[model samples]
Each structure stands twice: as C-alpha cells, then as structure tokens.
Target chain A: MRPDTPKVLFGIAGQLIMQIMPEVRTPIAGQTLTLSAALLSMVAQEFDRAASRLVEENRSVRTLLAASRDTVSEQALRSRIDAETADMHEHDFHVSALQAVNDRLRSLLIDVHAAVETTPGEAAAGLNERIWDELKESTRRRHLASGLA
Target chain B: MEPELAKYLTSKIPGSTGMAISNVFRIPGGASRETWMFDAAWEENGESRSEAFILRKDPPASLLASQRELEYAFYRAFEDSGVPVPRMRWIENGSEALGAPFFIMERILGCDSNTTRIQDAEYAPVRDAIARRMYEIMAEIHDFDWKGTAIEEVLAPPAPGECWKRELDHWEQVINENELSPQPIARAAIRWLRANPPPPPDRVTVVHADYRVGNFLYTVKGIHGVVDWEMAHLGDPLEDLAWSFMEAWEWTRDGRKGGIIWAEDAIRIYEEASGTKVNREALHWWDVFGSVKGQAIWLTGARSFQDGKTAELMMPFTSYWLINFQDEIMLRAMGRGA
Candidate 1:
C-alpha cells in the first residue's frame, strides 16, 4: 500500500519486459516472462475496480431479474427470481463475496433470458432487450486494454 | 531429454549409431502443446545424416484436450497433397518414450510464423501475395479428399446436417467442464446458435479448426507450411472461413481478417479456388459460433491454471485478456454490441 498497487505493479511489469525478458535464454522462458508482466498489468487494472464492478453488475442483474418476475411463466424459475431478489443488499463487501453474488445473479439472468425469449408478449420482448443491454454492459465492466498494445 | 531422444531415434532409424541431439529449444506461443525444435545427427548405413526436426509432445493439461494421434494423422494426410505441410516422421502413442504421447516432423526452416511479423513495413511488398495464397491454401485444404487416408482412420466424418451441431456440442461441453465462473454471454450465444443453426455444407470437408495467419509458416517467397492441426476434424468448410474472420486473431485491431487481407478479398479468393459460393447468412452464424469456441478455449486455459494443473503464465494471461474481449466480439457478431 505504500507505493500504491498500480504503481508497484507497473514498475514490476516494466522491469519484467525491459530487464528480465531479454535475459531469459529460452524462447519459452522469455514468452512466459512477457505474459507474466502482461497479466500483472491486467491484474493491477482489475485490483482497483474489481469490487465496484461486481457490486454494480450484481445490482444491475438483480434489477433485471426483479423486472422479469411477471414475464417468467414457470413456477420454479419464478420462485428462484423471488428468492434471489428478495434480499438485494450487499452485506459483504469482499471481492470474492461480491463475485459469488454476481455469479449467482448472472446465472439466474441466463435462465430468465431464455424464458423471456420464449414467453410471447411485448413485455417479454422489452425485457429481453433490457437483458441484452445488461449483457453488453457486463462486457464493458470487464474490458481491459489490449496486451499487445 | 536429449539422450532419451537420441535413443529413440537410434531405435527407429535402423542401424543408426551415435545419435546426438543438439540445439534443442522450446518454441513459444503453442499453448496447447510442448513444441520443441532440435537438430539431430546420426550414422545410417555408414552415411552421416543430420536433420532439423520438431517435436510436439502432449502437456499434462492443456487448453485443448486433442488427441495427438489424430493430429499426426491429419498432418500425415496433407503430405505432398498440393497443400504444404511438414513431413511427419514418427508418432509415439505410449508415454514410455517421452513422458507423453508425441510426434516428430521435419521442421520447415527460414519461415516466420509470428502473428505481427507481416504487419511490419518490410513485408508490405509481399503481404498481399501472401494473403492471397493463404486463402488459396485454405481452399485446397477443404477440397482435399480424406478418404482412405490416415485422417479417415482416426476421425469420423459427421453427417452434412450434423456438422454445426457436432462442433457446438463439443465446445459447449468444453465450457461446461472448464468454466471457473458463470458465463452468461457464452450461454446466450450457445442458445442462439442452436436455435438458428447454419445450413449444412454442400459436403463434409476437413475443417482446419485454427486456420488463421499465426498458424501458418510463411516467408517473403510465399506461404510454405500450414501447421497446428491439433483441432482438425470433419465439418462444414465454412467453419474455417468464419474462424479465419474472427476478430480475436486481428492482431492490429484492423477490420482486416488476420490483419492481412480484407474479408471480401479473402472470401473471393476462397470461393474462386474451391468453386463454392459464399453464403453470407451461414457464415455469420459460424462467426458468432467462433467467438463461443474462442471463449471456451480461454476459459479452459484459465481453469487449467486455477486447478494447479499447469503453471503456464499464458493460461492466465489469455483468461484475463481474451475472455471479456471474446464476449465483446460475440456481441458484435450477433449484432448486439454498442
């Protein structure tokens, strides 16, 4: 925390690419070092925003799930939607905990999306569009700069 | 490894004595296999013989669970068939010889296979010619007759209508087995692919599952060898065409396929060479399917590392760098992207 994580990580990545990679004798070793540095840079980028992304995504999927409760025709799926959206508070702020919640919600979102695609109505079609919007937003949340750049 | 390899060569090459291996080095970027290059010298029938060879050995766990024998058969099928490929020498199925199933082939020299190499200003003069030849060679690969070849022995040809289902089923199973977290986008893509399947090819042909630029060996002269046949199988030929057009292999972020040729030119060249009309709607279906397959590969690599089955840093790097990028590409392919 002293140097800040991104600064430290950028320094390490710089050293790996500029210093360590050239000294590696084998092509495989050099490639490994290069990829390690790239992974570190990506990890650093995620470190600062992982929790925020997960929380935001969990909230977005939860809202979508709640909106789809009426459109979902199956009893079992509706119960799942009710159970998952009942307590929407982020009680645990840990990245792992947030990610666990995000996974559960997104998995449910897939089922909801499949159901909505089949249940014929304007509401289902509208909700399906909203799901696609959320899915696109999800990619934006996890996007990283190209490593080759 | 050198002594063991020397022993194996001596045993295989009859009357070869004092077999020696040198300059052995592992090549980079082969995430699915341990590819090593080395030179060997031996005396056969009192004649001095030296050759450069490539060894493809199976890793304990890889991004792909391909059969090495099948890969060998695919490579063997293309030998001297107008499609340029390295000559296969020997294939060992048992792990007793090399700790894993492995195959050896004559290494093509003076060729560059790096993805970014052609983007340099130096290659500008021959880049178009090379790109044209790339598509021409792909047409040859698809037009190849695999009947009565080693390929037929190892691979079962899918029914014309079953091609799309077979590939989608295989990759979806891969994702189901290896995904570390939930993948909503990939799931949606799979559902869409199954609901709207691509029409079957005119006939079943060999689909070079990874036919992009990086997989081939090229020089200023022209394309020489098309390598990486680990995923070769019988499927719709358009699968390869759409795969060649995937954005994941677009190294320069250009709209060009493989950062070499425009999609239109590549499609024209492929169509002319194979005498098959290009179907835009069906190709779009495979383009979206390509992203799903790409995501499955990255996810498999991530799970391999997370489970401690491999320590290859490329595995995690691909997971971080390509998984989300692939989803974005899938979105664009499906016309749902911003």
Candidate 2:
C-alpha cells in the first residue's frame, strides 16, 4: 500500500529479469526465473483491474441474460435467466463473490445464446446480435495492457 | 539424479561394460515434459563410446497428457524422412526406472530453438531461408505416407469430413473439463465454429499438432531437428498450418506468422510444396479452432496447478500470459475483433 502493489511488483519483476536472471547458471532455473518475472508482470497488470473487470463482466453478462429471456423459447432456460437477472446489484463487492455471480451469469448466457440460435425471428436476431456484442465487450474487458496480441 | 539415470541406462544399453553419464542438466522450455541433456560415455568392446543424449521424462502433470508411446511412434515415423527429427533411442513406460516414463534420443547438437534469438536482426539473412524451409518441411510432414508405418499403430486417422468435428469436440470437452471460470468468448466462438464447419481435407496427413517456430531447432543455415511430438496426430493438414500461424507464436507481435514470414508467404510456400490449394475459409475455421485448442491447453495447465496436482511455475505463467490474449484472438478470428 505504501509504494503501490503494481509498482512494487514491477520493481521486483525488473530485478528478476535484469539482475537475478543473468546470474542463474542452470538452463531450467534461468527459464523458470524468466517465467517468474513474466508472471509478476502479468500479475501486476491484473492487480489493478481484477475487481473492476469481474464487476464489469458480471453486469454485462447479467444484462445479456436478462434480455435473452424473452427471445429464448426454452422454458427452463428462460426461468433460470430470469432468476439470475433478478439480483442486479452486487451485495458483496468482493472479487470472489462477484466472480461467483459472474460465472453463473456467463454459464446461463451460454445456455441463452444456444437456445436463441435455434429460433429464427426479428427478436431472436436482435438477441443474437446483443449476445455477440456482449461477447466482444467481454474480450475488451479482459484484454491485457501488455502488447501480447 | 544422474546416478539414478545412469544406473537405469545400464540396463537399457546392451554390450556396455561400463557407463558414465555426466553434465546432466535439465533443459528449459519443455512445458509438456521434463527434458534433460547429458553426455553418456561407455566402454563397448573395450572401446570408448560417447553420445550426447536427450531425455524426455514425463512430469506428474503437464500442459499435455499425451501417451508416451504414441509420441515415440510419431518421432520414429518421421526418422530418415524429409522432416528432420532427433534419432529416438529408447522409450520406457515403466515409471520404476526414472521415477516416470521417459524416452531418450540422440541430441541434435549446436542448434538453438530460442524464439527471440531467431527473430533478431543477426539472423535476418537466414530468416527467410528458415521460414521457407519451415513450410517446406510442413509440406513434407503432410505428404508423408503413414499407412504402413509406426504412426498407424498409435493413431487412427479421422475421415475427411469428420476432422473438424473431432477436433472441435475434443477441445470443447477439454475446456468443459478444465475451465475454472466460465468462458463466454470461447463459448461463442465454439458456437460459430459449429455453425460454419470447414470442408473435408484433400487427404488426411500427419498433423504435428504444435508445429511452429520454437518447436524446431535451427542454426543460421536452416532448421536441423523438429522436436515436441506430444500432440502429433493424424488429422487435417490445414490444422497444423493454421496452428503455426496462431497469433500467440507471433513472438515479435509484428504480424509475422511464427515471427518470420507473412501469412501469405507461408501459405504460398506450403501450397507449392504440398501441391494443394489452401482454402482461405477453411484456414480461417482452423485458425479459430487453433485458439480454442490453445486455450484448452493453457486451461489444462492452470487447472493442474490450481488443483495442487503440480507446482510447475510455467503452468500459471502460461495461463496468465495466454488465456485472455487467446480470447482476443478468438474474437478476431470470429470477425468480432474489438
């Protein structure tokens, strides 16, 4: 909290890559060191955005599930979506809780997307587009700041 | 460890009065197996005999869980073929020998497979040649006749039309079994892949399921030996080509497939060598499928790590590095790039 988590991690990763890695004599040990540094870099990136990404994705998936209910003809799927969408607010803002809710919503979203693809109509088409849109947005939410892709 | 391995080698190597294994060291970057390099010296017929050997021992859990026998057959099938592979010596499935099943091969010395070094300006003069030969060897791999070979013993070839479904279903099951969290993007891509399947391959060929730049050993002259046959199978040749073109292997992130040649150049070379036309639509389908397969591999490693099955740091490292990035690649392949 003093120097900030990301900054501290970046500092340690820089040391690992630049200083400690060169001193590692064994091939496997050095490779592990390099990967450790890389892991630090990725963890640093996630540390700043983990909670926000989880919350954003949970909300986005829940919204899609709610909209998909009317378009899907599957009775069980619609009821499940309705039940999941009923609680829009995050009573527990903890990342774990949000992720738990996120998993349920996204799982239901998959079911919704599958069900809607079977029916053909204006409403189903609209729901399909919405599902794709949310899927696209979901990638953006998880995109790393690192130039990996 | 060397003493134990040398003792094990004594039983495997015949007519050797004495044996000594020295300089035993673990080679890095073998995520699917624990690879080691050492020099084995022995007295055969009262004469000094030495060989540099590579040991590919199975880990408790790996990014892949391929059968060692199947992998051995694949490496054996390509020996003396156009494709260069290390000469496989022996394969032991019994774990009692070295704490796990392993196979030893004659190491192809004085070559590097480091991806970053191959992409550097120092190797610029040979990069084009290497890239060209890469595709040429791929063509050879696809052209190899496996009908009466060791390959047939390990793998059953899928029908042309069923290739996509088999691979898609396999990776989808992998994702289903290993994912710790829901993957909406992957799920959507999987749906699209199901909707638009590719045409049957012209012929089923040997698919080096992880064929790419880093998998092959090279000098500035050219590639020497292609390694890592853990995922080798009989399937669509296009799957291997598309996998080589995956964005993740674009180590430089400069749009070059395998950080060497452009996609068009790779395709042209492969087409010319293999005498087959690469359908763009089909390649696109495999490209997306490649991402799904890639993510499944990483997720498998991640789950292995999280479940306390193994403590290999590379597991979480790859998951952190590739999982989300692979999702973005899937989106792009699905024409939903954001």
Candidate 3:
C-alpha cells in the first residue's frame, strides 16, 4: 500500500509482460499471459478512477434528466425523470453502488433524450443538445489512462 | 485433439497412410473459433508428405455466432481468386468430428498478421503498398461473381436497398440479447441509424465484415492472405470499406484509416480498383453502424465471459478495453466527441 495500489498493479503487470510472458511455452499461452498483463494495467487504471468517474457521471446525468423534465412532453417520462433525479444522491461510495445509480440515471436520461428529440420546440432541442453533450462528457469521464489500448 | 484431427485427416486425404499430427498449437485472436495450427505428415504412395494446416473449430460461445458453413463457403468460393485467401480443404458439420464443427485450410507461412508490426520501421517501405493492395484485394472480393459459387449456397444476397436495415437490425438484436447493462449510447445510435438510413449499393457483394488491418496476413512485400471470414455476408460493398475505417482499427489512434492510409487516399484507391463510387453519405452511415456493431461484439464477449461459458481472458479484456472506447467512437462518428 505504500507505493499505492495502482503502482503495485502496474508492477505486477510489468513482471508478467516482461518476464513471465516470455517464458510461456505455447504461443496461445504466451499471448494469454501478455493479455493478462495488459488487462492488469487497464484494471489498475479503472481502479484508480472508477468510483470518482461513476459518481461524477451519475450526478451529471441526474442533473441533465431533472432539467429535461420540462422539455419532455411525455408526462410519464417526466415523472420517471423526476423520481430518478431525486434518487441521484449515492449513499454508498462503493464503485458498484455508484455504478448502479449511474446506470439507473443514464437509462432514464436515454428515455428523456428520446422524448425530447421527438418533441418539436426550442426547449426540446436545447435539452436534446444537452443530453448529447452529457453523453460525450460521460465517455470522457470513463476514459482510462493506459497504453494497453 | 491432435489424434482426432490426424484421424480425420487420414480419411480426407487420398493415398495417405500413417497420418500423424505434430506441433499442434492454438493460434490466438480467433474469438469466435478455436483456431489451431499443426503439421501433418503421412506416407503417400511410398513417400513422406508433410504439410502445415490451419483448423478452425467453433467454440461453445463467441463474440460472433456466425455459422461455420457460411465462413467455409466464403473461403472456398474465393480460392484461386484475386482475393488472397488460404485454400479451404474440408468442412465437417458433425460436431462429433472435433467436439464441434470445423474446417481445415492450408496454412500460409512466412507472413505476419500482427497489427502492431505494420507501423514498425521494418515495414515502412511496404506499408503503402500493403495499404494499396489491402483495398485492391477488397475490390477484387467485391467484384467476384458468387452466382453459382459455394458462397451462394450458404448466404442469400440481401436486397440492395435492404442491406443497411438488415445489418443494423442484426447487430441491434445482438446487443439486445447480450448486453448486461443498459447501453444508452448504443441504443441512441441505433435509433439514429434507423432514422437516417443509407442508400443501397448497385449490387450486393461479399462484405468481409471484419476486414481490417489486423485481419490480414502481410509482409514487407505485400499481403499474403485475407483471413477471418466468420462474419462474412452478402451485403453492400461499402459496408466493408466503412468497417475497415472504424476508428478502433486505427492502431495509430491518429485518424489514419487502418493506420496505413488516410480516408481520402484509401477511398481513391478502392474506387479506382473496385470501379465503384464512394458515396460519402452511405460510408458515414456505415461508419456509425460499424461502431454500433463493434460495441455489440464487445458486449457479446463480455456476456460470454460473465456467463462462465468461456474462460478465455480475451473476452473480458476486450470488454474492458473496447466497450467504452467503442462508445466514444460512436459519439465521435455521430459528431458528439467534442
């Protein structure tokens, strides 16, 4: 823990890739070992930012969904969005919990986006654009800083 | 496994006795099939005969669930054609043959299919030539006549105007069936795809659905063989072109299409060779569709890994690395990357 978890993971990944992978007898086994190393490197990256990214993205989507309520014409969708927005506060900081909350909110965001797009109004158009923007931002939030890709 | 393969080969080859398989090894990168390479030696008419062969056996589950017979037909149809493909020898549908249905082909030797090596300085001299021939061979594939060939026996040609809908519908269903979590971005992309469909091609041709930089065997001299026909289908030819241009295949990650040529250059070469016009609108539509299809593939592998159907590390590795990256690709293709 002194060198941090990510550093330790990368260290193990480096050993697997540079040392163990070469010693593997079969080609497929070697390739698997190499991929295992690369996976570790990427997993380390995800471990570093998984929680923060999920929490940030959940908040972002909930904000967009709440704002989309007025822009959507579907009453049912608006009510669902309101309920989802109200439930955005992630009581559990675990990555899995945050991701569950994120999934719920993002699924609602999709419905809100679909509703807003079909509704012909300036407000609907603006909300649609915001949804696209949030979607793009979400991709950035989940980006992993690893050379494996 | 080796003994069974050798036993099967003994019956397939004429005048062969004492058939034995050696150096049997798995070849990585075949996500859908359990691909293996081995050397088979037998006594043929009082002489020793040894040859290298590649076997592709279907796995229990995979990134793509295409019929092996269809893939075999495509390979067989293209034998001795302008498109360089390894000669397909035998296709057995009986799962009892090798625990699953499989086909055998002559192994292409002394060529590298590694996507990472093409950009290395060792291949710098022939990179452009490889890129040119890559598209040129693709043109040959598009131009091949499949009317009475084995290809027609397996895959029915889609209506020219229906290629877009057919492919989009297929991949959307794959995503719907396989996705563990809600794919909001992919779902939105699918909606947009339906809203704006591309025009059909003049003729439906053999679309090498997974044709890309890494999928082919190449050397500093040129490409030796185009492999991976599991996803091959009869569709709009531009679909292959656009799929090749998917950002995921751009190993350089610098917007170079396939990491060998720019989009304009690749199009120019392909157009001149295939005698087909590159419709920008249709190509753009296919590019976005390609991302959706790519995401579907990664999702399928993810599900396969999660379901304990496979212990292949490549499954989860692909899911972790490409799933979100594919989302970003779709966003960029849809003009929302900024």
Candidate 4:
C-alpha cells in the first residue's frame, strides 16, 4: 500500500461527505449513495476506455464515410466524404484527434442515416444495419457499473 | 424562502396563525414549478387549524412548461373523476408576490417516496393489485378530454404525427446543445425513431412524460397519487404506459417491468380499464422512445450539474445514478442489453 493510502481514503470520505451530504441524506439516501458509488466506479472504468472508445468510433465512422462515397447520391456530401477519407492519419492518434474525427463521423452518420431513409434497397438496409451495429458497440463501450438488485 | 417570506406567507393563510416551518427543505428541480414543503397552521376562518402545505412556485425557468394554472385546473376540473392528485388550492403566477412565484396546495400525508418499495417485502403482496390500479387510473386519465375542458387554451396544440417529431427534435436538440461527451446511443435511437415512425396515435391525450417508479405516491394497499407532472404534455397516452413499463425502472433488475406487474399484464390491465386496444408494435416504439427520452432528461440533469446551473439533489443524483443505466436502456432498445 502507498504511504498516503490512509490519508487518501480519509480525504475521499471527508470530501464526498462535505460536498454531497446535505443533498445525499434526503429521500432514499442509501439508494442514492450505493448508486453514486457504483456510477463513480464505472466512470473510472469509462475514464480508462474513453480514448479507446472514441478512437474505435472515429475509425468506424471513417470506414463508413469511405463506403458512402460509392453509394451516397448527393455529390456534395460524397465529395466531402471522399476528401475526409483521403486525409486519414492513423499514426499518433490521440483522444482529441479521435474526438474531432468522431464529431465529423457523427455528423456524417446523421446525413447517412437521413439519406438511407429516403432511398430504399438491400444496400441501404445493409448500411442501416451497419449503423445499428456501431450503435450497439457504442452502447457497450459506454456501459457503466450500476447497483443491481 | 427567507424566514421573513415564510412569515409573510403565514400571514396570508386567512386567519392569524403562528406556525413553525420545521425542516423546510428544498428538493431538486421542480422543472415546471418550485416545490417546497413546510408546516403551516393558524385560525382557519375562526377555529384553530394546522396542516402541512406544499408551495409550488412558478420560476422564471419554467415559463414554457405545462401551464401552472392549467395543470392545477385539470385536477380541479376532474376532482370527482377519481384521478388522485393533490388538491391545488392556489396558483400565483406573478413574481411580485413572493420574489420568484408560487402556488400552494394541501400536502398529502403519510406516504413514503422510496423507489424500491414496489418489490420490498412490505409492499410485494399488494404490488400486483397496486400496479393494476395505477394502470387503471392511467387508462381513465387517457380517456379524459383536455380540449372541451377548462385549460385547453394553455397547452400546446396536439399535432397529429408531429407529436413524436416535435418532442424528439426538442430532446435531441437538448442533447446536441449540452452533451459533455459524444452521445452515440441517443443519436442512434433518434435515427431509428425517425426511420420507423409509429402509427399515428389514436388521438392525442395528456401524456405524463415522467411516469415511472419513484414518481408516484402509493400505499401498501394501492396508489394514492401519481406526483411530478413537470413533463406532462399533450401527446399519445400510450407514452405513459410505455414509460412506466420501461425495463430500466425494474428496480429489481429482473423481468418485473416496474417491480409491479409484467409488461403484458400492465397492458392487459390498462386495456381492460380504458377499453382501448394495445398496439403492440406502436407500444414497442414508445418503449424505445421512452429510453431515449429518459436518457435525454438524465443527460440534461448531468449537464446541469456539470454546468453548475443548479447544485440541486436531482441533477447530481441523475448524473451519477441514471446516466449509466440510460446507456443500458439504449442497449436494450437496440436489442443489445438484457
């Protein structure tokens, strides 16, 4: 154990109680505390995974954006998509870079989603399923620890 | 309120009364109104009187919420209609009276607000019957008309298919504007929602957008009242049923829908009471929609906490407690989570 471990635990209890006790001790406080501790623990997990999750999402989005160039009929969106695909830099990927790409990809997702809604076919269906696939993965990535039962 | 303000309110309660405001606590956001509970007493007309009264003030933030007067008027209009709501005695909208704004109502007595009670041993035996009764009340509410009534002018117009669209756009817009991190789950849910629009509702009815466990007041015998009408709106009534039946609210984390009844049984009970058929597919749509809506609200609360908009209980509580489960709800809606 670290030399300051006792102090750290003491600090945690002191800080949490000092900050949250007034509101925490209201209706169903125990439930609130248990849930809060679980969430804080999960946030710690998500903290470890955040950059990776964003990196993966950004990569997935880039792949979809590239694929969209073949089928998305809107010339402007297609040209933009191709340009984004051509500028791919997987080297030295950071959380901020992933976040930037994630934003662009999400914007593209909205367009792609709307586009597929208008045009109907097996191809569109496949793309829709791909979007859903990403969505499911994203949810899995974002899952947090919570009190059950 | 300041002690002076509390004393002033004590003065306005009709007769000369000296009462103490014991543990006058402020809960989290009322969203639609400022809700505070305090003890009040005085000579009512002539004789001695004492009782707990809750003050619901209309804050500057809640301007476009469900009309305060109208919300009160609904129950007042339906006083004999059997939907159990607190007797809303007075609604004061003008801010001049009490710094912000407020309403007063008789506080319903002796009820616990724990969200876990439905499955608790004390209440388990009666949960089924209470569940049925709650659904029955909701069905009756769905059957009631808000148009040919007193406060029709106050609520937003009930659009046909645009109801879902309007609500979705607003909530999605909120997520877009305030989200601290990427919200891919809500984003996916929105796409799915618009892509597969549910059948146009049978008719728009009063929707209690936040109908779930922990929001309602109940006894071991049955539900006495369903509280927290902050998100009440004019929309498909089935939205309430679906929101109530959402699996995340299964406090036991089992198949028990709201720790009250099974999903099928909930629908059956509501249908039996309202004489309306349950559209399974549409209800399924609303169930998914409920998760999205739930996430949006929880996210908003988290944003409030992060932004320091209000250090209120609910904001942090939701940010901590409900946000993760919201993702789980998303996974379930996407056919991923259990």
Best by TM-score: 1
DockQ, prediction 4: 0.30
Model 4: runs farther than 4 Å from truth?
A1-39, A90-98, A117-123, A147-149, B2-5, B27-34, B44-46, B57-70, B96-99, B156-166, B169-188, B316-324, B334-338
Model 1 bad stretches (over 4 Å): none
Model 1 C-alpha lDDT per residue in residues B1-338, reported as the tens digit of each score: 99989989999998899899999999998878999999999988989999999999989878898888889999999998989999999999899999988999999999999999998888999999999999999999999999999999988899999999999999999999999898988999999999999888998999989999999999999999999999999999999999999998887787888999899999999999999998999999999999999999999999999999998888899889889989999999989997
Q: Per-residue alpha-carbon lDDT of model 2 for B79-128, expressed as tens digits? A: 99989999999998898888888999999999999888897787999999
For model 4, name the residue pairs that clash.
Answer: B57-B102
User: In order, what lDDT does every prediction score?
Assistant: 0.92, 0.89, 0.88, 0.70
Give me the displacement of residue B108 in model 4, in angstroms: 1.0
Candidate 2 chain B lowest-lDDT run of ten = B9-18
Clashes of each: 0, 0, 0, 1
Among all windows of 10 consecutive residues in model 3 chain B, the one with the lowest summed lDDT is B58-67
Model 3 DockQ class? medium
Query: What would the TM-scores of all predictions be?
Result: 0.98, 0.96, 0.96, 0.83
Error of 1 at A31 (Å): 0.5
Which lDDT tens digits does candidate 4 get at residues B160-233? Answer: 68878877787788777667666666776788888888887878888767777777778886777777776777
Candidate 2, which segments miss by more than 4 Å at Cα?
none
Interface RMSD of 4: 4.5
**Which pairs of residues clash in candidate 1, taking residues 3 or more apart in a chain or in different chains?**
none
Please name the candidate that would achieve the greatest DockQ relative to the true structure: 1
Scored by TM against the true chain B, the candidates give 0.99, 0.98, 0.98, 0.88
Better of 1 and 4 by lDDT: 1
